[model samples]
Target: MCAKTLRSVHEHRKPASLRGRSFKRPTTGRFDINGDERKFKKKHSKANGIVSPMPNGKPTTSKKVNGMVNGVNGHAVVHMEDEADTSSGRGVATSSKYAAIQEQRANLPIARGETHSTIPAISIHDPSFATIGKEALLNEFREHDVTVLLGETGSGKTTQVPQYLLESGLAGEGMIAVTQPRRVAATSLAARVAAEQNGRVGSVVGYSVRFDERSSTDTRIKYLTDGMIFRELLSDPLLSKYSVVIVDEAHERSLRTDLLIANLKTIQQKRNDASQGKGKGKEKEKERLKIIIMSATLDAEKFAKFFPGSKIIYVQGRQHPVTIYHSAQGQLDYVDSAMRTFFQIHVDQPPGDVLIFLPGQEDIESLDNSIRLYANQLPPNQQEVLICTMYASQAPGQNAKVFNATPPNTRKCILATNIAETSITIPGVKYVIDTGKCKEKRYLAKNTGGGFDTLMTRDITKSSAMQRAGRAGREGPGFCFRLYTEESFKSMALSAEPEIMRSISALKTLFLIGGLDQSGEITQLGREMAAFPLEPVYSRAVLASKEYGCTNEVLTIIAVLSASSKVFVDSSEQRDAVAEARKKFKHGSGDHLTVLNVVRAYKDVALSENKSGRREWCRKHFLNERALLEANDIREQLQQTCERLGIDWKVSCGDGDEPVIQSFGQGLAMNTAFLQPDGTYKQTMGQSTVKIHPSSTLCDKKAPTIVYDEVVYTNQIYARGVSIISKSFLAGLGALKVRQA
Candidate 1:
């Protein structure tokens, strides 16, 4: 018997809800089972009086007699042919259900004059949707393939535009993909959109980030990190699945965002060529991919010229006017000024939260302690003050409380790094204290060498200052207390330099991966490098590991280096304890191998315990649990990329740590330095003098030559993560260009 026939028989034998219904007759049908015809009785209900022929001339639906019937006991032998073919008829039922749902949705009234009203009521009531520019925003998309959308923080562009596209049937062919620079923003925006549509997350609206994805095939709109979208390009260069690509927060100008925009231009050109019947097989473009670039403070004219035919749409944000305050003179100590300003606002201003922007985590922590001390001094009857600190490396569980509403009769003071400048929204903030500084990673060329040092702290640009000021007005009319004088503000740069302008090595690596030669010609290696999710430095390291036969260990080292947060947590009070705990993973070679040991130990512990126990284990060892988790995730991704590129990477570590260290030297040979007799180090390339960072385990012990991960300058130039290596190893790697003094 066919599968469907068997299913029908099984379904009939099972208890069902239709027990009260009476059968009229048993229809005549073929008995294909066992290839034999089985005679059965027909039954006719007295009410209906319908009749059918049976071998016994008795009713088939009659109650069993003496528990014996047509070759069976206490069971009616029903023919399979009498049942309707449910498998073939199910499509109609499904289609009808969907049609009814769609019809009901179509009947709902459009919110705020939008073409569709599936979004939340608050979104519809946003002033951007009711503004005069709303129509122009829609019309621009209809006319141009690329649109530069400029709006301030409170503008509804980020949340509403995608829905507008969906309502207009512009995204009917495929999903509308929106990219955010940070993961938190993507996931939060997805939740807000899902709430507006009255749908559960991961259905019509979803988000994807590093190691976390909450999207399904039915997702009509997706919010993903810019890095996530770049990874998608490795698999689908054309991004064929998305009909519309929205790059939000374009003003941030991150490395990934810049590369994605450049690659997207290439994608659009390819699609145009394909549509013109120029490519192999003459496969016409199935859909024309539309692009929308949204930014709070965009360089509109520059972007317009970049995309020749693109149009610019400026939407005024809905925000109350904010009053700005500047110091009478330039304040040399911003931390002191910020503290004074905080108390001033708390004591004089109306009840609202205070947001103080600092340069880095160190500043946030120091200021947070000071604020708490001052809060404790206040009278117990006074309104309570809650202090919170926010930085990228902060634990997520604590970060969630940053957005919670303050309790009645209490005020919240959030001391944060530049992360709050654009990546997040902290509600109920009515006062903003801007230090006019932020920690920016800049590549400073060595005075006498070809290489550069990475500087992690720098002054904020004028554009950044404006973004910081705008945060105060997000909720209501507010005040911005600038720690610097107006003259100092004007002296700042127009905008922070783009990542592309600062990192030449990164650009060179990108070209190499794009298959471009010295003269900028594309090569096969360049193409493969573009697909790797790591920076060119790490990607080159993994690619080179294959030659040294230590790809697995090198991959792990790179993942640890790419951790989202600091792996080591050291505070003044627990410095000795933290150091003692970290010593367990020291491999006696350098920080690089130490990192490998940490990863191995973490994995071993993670496997043997539940998640909570694993967290406790990391805590006991003074390791950042989140950082280790992120590193493990990155390691897995890099390994997958290696496999995809057909690199023969062994899954296990080699016999010893020497081979792995040698492989790392092969990739970072140019970063080698020689130890000077004076206890300072000199770079092999420029003979530049540097000191070993205090954090490096090899700082005290000396070796002739060392390979370092980075050279950063704070009070003095310091080589961090120093690993000692033999002179012979350096010579073999061709890194002994500068003779040891």
Candidate 2:
């Protein structure tokens, strides 16, 4: 599942630009029309500098909040409130505002620690529904170990049954953490449930996202990301605090979700004895963990068999009558035909936003371009529909717009990835167009080695098609147009493959972190890695940082690279700036040394000014302030890892440029390459004929040389590869190979 909440770096301040150079930050000024000379939350804004917060699912523009713009470089200081009130006071009262949600959870005939207002619940009273459905399901479930949940959209099983366990108190004080594949659902559902219980959101119905957190100790019904819940397992093996764990959006088959199910099964076989729990009152906390799996169209029967004694409850969704249609014309000129179909539906049919599914990023971009270009040519009456794009790679501001409503008389079009499939709930999506395609990432053959990573675009799975179809039928009777044939849909995979079996695992990461064997089970050092809230590789980097006394350095890199908080200034000027950076390092080594040399130079420059000036100066050099922030996080994690190993991270930050190469080489040792007799060098683990990316330092020059810069494990070798040798080693390796040449 995707991360629930990605942090916002720019909220109000405008990105500053300088003449004759790239964007420059405030080096000395207190305010450049924006206060405190803070970094911009967004760039290229036409609006005056005003920052605003989106609180009620409504989109608002920048207007300073309490005199503060949600500036990118601004610190996110959680307004520490009275923990009690902040935890549970307003959730129940506020949740009463929604009628449908209130009817489902609050009005149910149930017992609880606190009494809820009496309201009648809508029940499925069909005789057939009661007799053959659940009872028949029980018999099928009794004989199975894993089950797939197959139900239409609006299935009550997703939300209601989790409450079934809660009301039964089968979960006990042990928490029931349900992981949603998307953030909006996690946060919205958490608030809805908290309000039902007459408690605060964070208290009993809390959600823990990346930047926005609303969970507290009183919280018993917690909603989190699939990955977040998975990581939590490493911290609490038996999940002693939670009695029931629900994996929502199982059809998505995200990488972490797959790992979570497998890990859960692993834990179940060798159940962690309650007596072994690290938490206090551990044994008394030993409660049977309940596994509840829910999905829109999953094969629930199969999943039930996977876990013997597991029960599957199917709840029908509130989906309205939806009519499916195929494009009028055949395959050729289909994109144009698709637009005509969309235009006809928007004008002749009804008023609601349109959800269009495409193969991948390229397809989404192509379809969106066509729509926008057509909008300009349309009549004045047709030009009113506000067109927007939605994809994972989109900037933060753009993604937010897809969820908000369009102005009156204007229709909004949402172009999304499979991410829009199940977890996210977009209002007004009454029309859906399916492309029957999705981009998938997979590893190439090991014989090709690490250099050739393949990004294959494949046909959508059957579950993906159902998910796309469900998007249209949410509000009322809607229309869906399919680009492919029904036969093709039937031939598709039953479900998207699970992630763990497909993608790269932390085998290398775990090996380094815990020194574990290939299985990634615990090792001496890995024991500490298991305690961290990050992936094994990320944890290993932190541990290694401590050993090298570079704790401060690693943290900054991680925070910046993490992409969530950074404004992600993809400036073309980074290459030019590196050229300038090398001038300070005396060009004694290579690009790795260039970064170290430049960072030191920047820090020294900062010492002459305040931290505010430091940020401004960084932007001027095409450097990212947020990257520096992440680097600091990586450093701190490393420092902590070292302390756990009884090592003090007090070593001074080093400055010698030549020694820096050797330091980088040890861990990046696997990246090293050697020149062959014919002058072709092998670099990748699979030794594909790879070349450096244009952005790498090695790409700028060529000799009888083997350099490491711009490396990836695709079907083809790429650039920006990092190597284990210094520039001097290049000369030595070149000498031996030059004779062969």
Candidate 3:
């Protein structure tokens, strides 16, 4: 069913009291129902009153009422029928207000060819309709099975192209699937498109991400992450549910995005071959899957060569001209240079917000601190400055504040990483400070085994530098101050290397688990691992846990790892308190066992307290309540995945540290490292030097051998999520050879 049909069914099912009601706009600019206008009356209650300012800058009177009401000169009024009281008596007034607004909208005059809808109508006067090359894009899709769409930053390709396909009836019986590189983009775009279509979300338009989904069977247009679509391929190899697949943000070239494009190409070939040999009826003919590659800075010729005879469509972006400034000399410390440039723009430039792009959280924090110290020296007459931070691990609530409008007589300086480059848009940003560097994950190759390291900070590509500069021009004409010289930018690479060159373990594991023979054919295990929504290493660990007799414990550990990092909150002020509270859950075996203890204790506390109490418990103990809650959700989902793969979900070796450690070690045998005499650790397989991170519980303690979740280079090379393991246990895994120095 379409959204319009669903909405009609819902309208017919409304309560009798709400149906056939007449609404009128009163002379006072307020809603009056059934031709009746009631006088304002004040009522007193036990709760305190709220006072708000009116348009004239005078405070409006407030009074207690049975439910929430619009403040009108201290009046407590109810606009709906008396019998339609809410369970809490507070929601009725809000509902009645919305109902009146809907009725008023329904009675509004429509254009000659416009259709009426209960939902707000989308304006047809959007500038994209006039500027975008709509006819050329539609014609390319109509003629070719594959097409590469190149658009500049504000080109409207992301939103406009999908709607064009929907309106042209290209979706057929399947959905028009659009893949985004980030969850925020997918969800926000889906909501925007749903509004433009005059429909509700999850009906005509929807989105799906890692832990959340708002799509339904009635959905004709779906937006999802690249990773989510990759998982879908394991079940529906032909993508039978989607007629058109759009890969957006292909310029980023993330690991999953590249994998998805490669797989889609293969699927396209097989489907075409099948269609050529079919004695098909008119209704049973298989429709060839149409693929559209959309990017803001995509190399059109390269993609054209990859997909033979593929057409390319270019759309012009609507962006203000941006002034670029390059450094005369390279500075030893980019952080200091960024600080000076930010202050210069604030004092000399016109009133506008500033966005400073740094390498990581540490760099952002350092620059933010320096800005504050310098801000204090400003004259009292100068406007105040508001500083915000943006990073991957930032709390969601705090992240929202970065997008809020700047207050009058003040400016906002958002210190961010590459996350703000293309994933999010911040308004009122007219100036950009580019550090010209970012942390990229790269794989190290040695004679022996090697793992991935993510702390390698390097100069960004010329393409990325341009993307950062484009942020300044999003709102209006602006300026970008690069900390590097023009000569240095010209020496940079054309684009960052693809993810396939950086990490191959997940790909290798996928092939192994798929049960492909020596020739690399898919096996049963590979199909199961693809269905599991986890990294290949973690997926393999879960499957191995069943054989090692600790599936339940390993499931919990993997889910927690997948959900978030260590649950302990890192606050300098509460460091001692957090460590003291965490003592109750320490298992001495390693961080993995400690995580198991934390999850079990959380469950126990949740069973004993109410919702608020559980949240309070986390705060009191300095634990991340969100991470723990997300872990629980993932744990339930992983349990279902295990059951579907025919792995026993209830098997356990009882509550002991040995079995759990052994189970996790089975999959992480190559990650084992042993202590050395020089107070450093070396990986048993790769022979790489490593050290325990200072944040780990076992940081100061000495252990002969340990297993780690990952290696990170910050102040120095360190292994995070460290845990002590028995030498005998390492030897028992069979992949490691126990050798003593």
**Structural similarity to truth (TM-score) of each candidate:** 0.75, 0.68, 0.77
Give the alpha carbon lDDT tens digit for every residue of 404-444 in model 3.
Answer: 87899998999999989866778789999888999887666
Off by over 4 Å in 3: 1-133, 277-286, 394-398, 447-454, 506-531, 564-566, 572-581, 652-654, 734-741
lDDT of 1 by residue, 208-327 (tens): 998889889889899999989987887899998887899987776778888888888888887766667654321332456789988654355566667887766655444444556666
For candidate 1, the clash count comes to 11
Model 3 residue 351 lDDT score: 92
Best by TM-score: 3
* lDDT score, candidate 1: 0.66
Order of quality (lDDT): 3, 1, 2
Instruction: Tell how far residue 671 is off in model 2, in angstroms.
Output: 3.6
lDDT against the true structure, per candidate, is: 0.66, 0.52, 0.67
Each candidate structure's count of clashing pairs: 11, 79, 8
Measured with C-alpha atoms, the lDDT of residue 210 in candidate 2 is: 49
Model 3 TM-score? Answer: 0.77
Tens digit of per-residue lDDT, candidate 2, span 1-741: 011110011111112221111122324322121222211122214432211112222223322111112221332211111111233335456544444444544322111111111111211111233323333443333333333444444333444545555665545667878888766667766765665565667886788764467877777788888867766665787776776677877756677776787777766555435334555553444544556676543555455555655544444333444455543323333343345556656656567888887655555655565566555545566536676666664544556788776888788888888767753567788898877777777666555444345566678876677667656755555667776655565567767667756676445534532448556566776676565545555455556666555644444433334434432333222556645643554333445545555556666877798887887776665456555555555556555756776655565345543333443433343345655565445652334665555545555344333434235533345645332355464444343333323
For every candidate in turn, the CA RMSD to the true structure comes to 26.8, 15.0, 18.7
